[model samples]
Target: MFLNNDLGPTLEKIFNDSDSLKSLSIALGNASIQNAQIIMGTVEISNISDLHQFVQCTVNFTSLTVELDDGAWVCVGPCQKNPNFCNQQGACQNEINGPHCKCHSSYFEKYYGAQCELYSRGAGFYAVLFGCLVAFALLIIVSAVMIVVFYRAKRTSSKKFELFEDDFFDFTSRGGYGHQNFSVTEDSINTTATEVTDEQR
Candidate 1:
């Protein structure tokens, strides 16, 4: 009579007790059914927390149970608020190394701005340098052309002046004097000289 009362007669009532026993059974069964082991962990405190912090929390589980059904075992580790721990392109509060951010090797983080950002080599650096070089080259080419043109022009002008001086001197001498007396006197002297020579002979 007492045993009957202790075990409830109703199926719903019995199931309520059975469910609680099944949870314990499952936990115990998981250890033997799959190869499982506990994970060890440690923590570092950068600043003392005013609120309570977790020393450790552990739960029994089958470590060998493939999570994705592809032979990869479940991961057991300390709890973290951020999910981007393993992502190379993402940042997380749970970053293993540096601050609460994770950056790819090619990137860097600025302390004042966005926690994680891509480092950029500014376009202005190349633009200014290249612009200066182009300007310098243009200046050199223009200067060289100007020097060549100036020298050629000076040489041509000097030659022209020399020609003009020679022409002026020739025109100002006897041929350009245009005097009729000078020619007549020169011809009479020539004739007198010839007569004297003849008389002497």
Candidate 2:
């Protein structure tokens, strides 16, 4: 017989009266059994006049929560949403902490974007373009240098030819045999001398 205003003492007495039910509650509390169900059947009591009864009970279990390495707690269960929540070319994964997006393995190396669709042509294209530019610059510089060298050589050769002509003309003038009228003057002087000698004879 149990009489109490406190519900704890009344519940203890009721649980002590049933060994099987107490064992089941203990098993459920320790997480030994995950699920249970109850079914009602036709009741037959001995020497009962008018039986009217009402019973209600409430049970609570531990909430399933997981703590991540980042010190974040997340409820562990199936994702109620779609797995493809991430947009195009992206994949979604249900982690212990939460769901996240990851790029595909094919694009993992050189592709990056909101959808992992952008690709890089690597450094080779830029290297080739830079090499071509440098070659063109070198060609222009070499051509300019060659043109300058040829022009200087031609000017020096022209100066040498002019100097040789000047030297030749100076030498002919100093020898006194290159005057235009010297031969005519000498012939007239000889004619005069011969005339004078014949007269004397």
Candidate 3:
């Protein structure tokens, strides 16, 4: 039998009389009353016990049903049932359809997966992060090596050019005197040739 209204008064009468019912078990359905609105979910119940304590307990009943079991009537009350439908990293929200799993606010930053299981800074993230770090380090090392090589090459080239400049200056100074002697020899040869031609004429 399901009792929709007069739940509190009927339960009060049952609890007032101890001999009215025995071995009564309340299978509280998975429905709750919040702000005069009924939210339904899975069904849950409590162990068979005396109705005195249940009547005193503050339980919002959405559906009250009675069942006969072993010659005793069991009056089931509305129990707050926790379906735990939410995921490991989420909390369950009771909606019109059913319980919905929603990720916590703290998980919004890095977690976004089927059940909010994946994190942004997970293994893949670390792998890419380390790869970038290694690449940057290698770039710095390569740049340093190039700078060193360039510096050494520049220094070697400067030294070679300095040595060549010294040799060229030395050769030019020596070659100037040799060129003057060659010019003098050529002039004497020309004068001798001119006298011989005059004799022949």
Q: Supply every candidate's count of residue pairs whose N, Cα or C atoms clash at under 3 angstroms.
A: 0, 0, 0
User: What lDDT score belongs to each candidate, Candidate 1 first?
Assistant: 0.49, 0.55, 0.54
Pitting candidate 1 against candidate 3, the one with the higher TM-score is 3
Model 1 / residue 104 / CA error / Å:
14
Per-model TM values vs. the true structure: 0.32, 0.35, 0.36
Model 2 ranges with Cα > 4 A deviation: 1-110, 117-121, 170-172, 180-201
Residue 28 CA displacement from its true place in model 1, Å: 31
Candidate 2: the clashing residue pairs are: none
- Put down candidate 2 lDDT per residue, 1-201, tens digits, no spaces: 111234455555555555656577787885343233333333454322212132111222132234232443333422324544454546655554555557544422344564466666546667777999999999999999999999999999998888677557654566666646445688799999999999999
Ranking by lDDT: 2, 3, 1
> The CA-based lDDT of model 3 is what?
0.54
